[model samples]
Target: MISRMLVKMIAVLWVGIAAGWLNPAVSYSEEASEKVLKLHSGLYYTIQKGDTLWDLSERFFDSPWVWPDLWQKNSQITNPHRLYPGEQIRLFSREETQTMVVESRPEPEVAVEPQEPPYYFYPPINSVGFIKERPVRPSGAIFKVKGNKAMISYGDLVYIRPIGRPTFTPGDRFTIYRVLEPLKDGEIKADVGIQHCILGLVEITEGHPKFAMGRIVQSRQTIELNDLLMPYEARSPKITLTQSKKRLEGKIIASEGHERIFGDQAVVFIDKGRQDGVRVGQSYYIYEQEKERLDSKKKEDLLLSPVDYGDILILHTEETTATALITRAEKTVRPGARIRSPF
Candidate 1:
């Protein structure tokens, strides 16, 4: 029997991290490689509702990056991208399984929308989360505001240093984030990262990379001086819940506002991140671990299985932390609760 259930990682994470996988020792001529169809076989998993081949790859091989690779190996599957419940999936082994001729599928056309660092909207903005890890120092900051204004908001003149000729162009846009305090895992102060809070966004109005000025195109919160400015790229991802290919245990480290107790539509933070095989858009059930109160005498305390507090949609991820928005909650969830893959 399989020891436990599994969770999933992202399918679109293949550009880097090749060093961690095995390299083929045998080399074949171009003609020989083209003629043969590569096939791999290993233990099989019975698919359940909402199971995807990418999820299977993550479970058997700890990689969601190779669903297409797995697709080429199976004679039974026409499209690895599509899957159904109660089907047996053969997961190929690396040492013995190799393939030629990968069946291709029509690449789905995706619409690119203007993205925030990573924000979401499904039933409105209920929660906003953050991560505490080694933060990347921004390339620029809001050094001074024009007109000596106390604060700046959407559409304001601002002067930046260094001038744009060397480092930035006049049309380039940047994500605005205010660096918050460092959050610790427990009590340790040495292990810390600046809590980067997404403030809004800015478009370079004039100048160069060394010194540039821009207008606040949008603002979710108050824009202030010294706010960190990072080169912006559209990262807002469409999120949905799916089965996890692995059983990952993570903790709720903080609430959106660091509140002790929070209810429906609140944003929260978790300890899991990209380095831990967590991907943005994957959902996990938030749970609370508790010990059952004794009744008639077993002499020792018994801990109950974790109770489901709610579910959360991961919005963004860092190396060691992730920002998630709460979809549902009961009992006013708090930090220190555990989160595991949705079975």
Candidate 2:
């Protein structure tokens, strides 16, 4: 019992020392935007010019990486950089600050940069895509081309049969996609959802109710026969840095550039989406499973920890999948890589 109290006291003292490093500076900007703020038992220190969250977290937590928890605690500062120069951040006692600690460590000689390369040993959850359940089938596939061409490009004419019927208004628009590959599933079935590459968009100009005539209006990639079509829906979700409430495990199912590998700012698709509780603005860390490597000198295999690339932020979410931008990556990221929450 005495040891427990001693441990707790040491923890609080450590935190107090860390928090003491920050000195209050008056916030100067009046036009700057303010965010949601949390109430805690601490003195208020106004933000000032040249101040960065990294600096503040380091000052208060002794480790710059705790900024996310700091943001979460404050909640009001939606954008870390948009902190109003004049806004006040409440500083709290060490005991109170203990609630914000995501990780604890002994005192170190060097200060670490929170946003530096390989921000986490494991990627966060939002960046990892997950599919909790099988997704519904798309509208239909490109049955045949106007000239019966196997492949078609922008402005090409095409015909499509609604998944089961030819019952659509002639002027409806649809997004076209090429089925890429199937993802991991407990069981394999032809009807199960698979990763898809959006080929282009088509607008029905003329044709029968069951079979419609349409023209490829825009093509990010060449359109081809048998490419599936989905009802087009305009989307533009406001994405911000957000935290996940629950731990979710998922993988990168697809990528936008169709590149063999991805890196920072590269858009990728995850298997998890809205139904799985993933939302736009949430972030995740990307990592590849640790593998055993051959050591030439020892002539033996050495196991290495999972390689952390960096974080990915969910830009958009659908029913069973989400698209994310790899906001940071220390190494090349690729589909099948895993993602999870940092905390």
Cα lDDT tens digits, model 2, 1-343, are 3344345435645644665532222132233223212222344555767778898766545567767666654533546767766555555544544443423433466676566332222212222222324443778778888777766865577888778653456567777765544555323322225555656667777767567778765555667778777787644223445677378888776576557787876778777888889887788878777656576677567667766668888766778778777878998777677898776
Model 1 deviation from native, Cα RMSD in Å: 19.1
lDDT (C-alpha, whole model) for all candidates:
0.61, 0.61
Q: Predict model 2's lDDT versus the native.
A: 0.61
| TM-score of every prediction relative to native | 0.59, 0.48
Residues 1-343 of candidate 1 have per-residue lDDT tens digits of 1111111111111211253432221121233223222222223444566767776565544567766656654424534666655444444334333221122223577798665444343421211336656676676778898888998875677776542333666667777777667876553334435577777767777875357888765466788888877777664234544445389888778776778887666777788888898887788888877787587566677888878979888777788888877778877787777789887
Minimum summed lDDT over a 10-residue window in model 1 is located at: 7-16
Runs of candidate 2 with Cα error greater than 4 angstroms are 1-135, 185-193, 246-260, 271-276, 287-309, 318-321, 334-338
